[model samples]
Target: MSLDFVNTYSQLINLSADADPSTFYSTEDYRKLQTLGPSLPTLSYPFPSAEANLVGESTIDVKLKSIRPPFKFTTELKAIPGSLSIYKLKNQLIDEVVSLKEAGICASNLKFMIKSKILTDTTTIGLLGDEVSITVMITQPSHNDTSKLLSDPEPELEAPKSISKGAWDKIESVLSADLGPEAAKIAVSKFKQVSI
Candidate 1:
């Protein structure tokens, strides 16, 4: 039969039409109708819909870059699903890119940001967009984490530490600075929003 591939919607297919056990095998059966061969009858299939979906979720490309640091990395993570959590992306970075552990950065210490906004662990890649480019920053470990690396851990003092009254007064004065007459008003409004 003749291949009516003249239509804009169709092209000559090489693999199985059913798409089961998905694979490609260039056997003599598909030596091409162009070259001398027995022509198979063209079976017209329905036009592919614009939303002809995949069996699973589609993947997005993630581009991560660290502009400055002791640990600098630039890489494109391909075909990653948007549903992937920020935590998983960090692990992927460690696995695929730099030696993060050697740079004193664990997955927990990694920060993913889009411009000024930071991403939480629960944030998914898909929430960003079809493709995401983010800035990666490595944070220094917390005081508790730093203590663990010491050969001898310091013993806790019986009394809690207290700031000097003069220092406290100086800090309060700085907060009450007169950048303008309305500076204190603005600072108070901002401080009200802070949880602590």
Candidate 2:
């Protein structure tokens, strides 16, 4: 069974935040997370299609410079197959991070560098997609006494590819069978349609 693309991606993002970066990054879990990034455009599809079908591709690059104490990073977004105003999207992201800080989920050390651009006009009845690549690096804070000690090297381990596949299957089954068509439709109705 196939999972909702957006939900899967969202879950992956949350999981990454909760899991140890070394373990998550070294395993196939990270690769599966990358797959979710590319499907963003398709997942953003608005319901009740007009006479003309909209299609486009976008690429998002996220770099996590640090994940300890204070998170720092940069992101770049570029539309490849359609014209898109990314200012709103960028603002939304920053707002979310700020909200997290306000809620005490993250420290005030959070910082982001963002660059976005629209590339081309949308094409009708064509393929629309997005590719996202994320790089993560975790560093010890300068103020920490442990920073003076030698960093413990991550243990070499085989990447567990089946773990993610199993997770996907479990999530797909629940979403497909438990939600029901009506509930899913109602949920989708809540999101505002975006103009490509």
lDDT of 2 by residue, 1-196 (tens): 2567667767867764344667666667666553432235445556755434343333343322323344454444344223333333333344545533343332222232223322222222122234433232323323544644557655789765444545545554565577876665454344213211
Q: TM-score for each prediction?
A: 0.44, 0.19
Q: Pick the candidate with the highest lDDT.
A: 1
Local distance difference test scores for all models: 0.72, 0.41
* Candidate 1 deviant stretches above 4 angstroms: 1-54, 142-196
Writing each residue's lDDT as its tens digit, candidate 1 over 74-158 gives 9999998767899999988888874675555678988899987999999989889887999998876554665566867788677
| TM-score, cand. 1 vs. native | 0.44
In model 2, the runs with Cα more than 4 Å from the true position are: 1-82, 98-130, 133-196
Question: Could you give the C-alpha RMSD of every candidate to the true structure, in order shown?
Answer: 20.6, 33.5
The number of the candidate with the highest TM-score is 1
For candidate 1, the per-residue lDDT at 130 reads 87
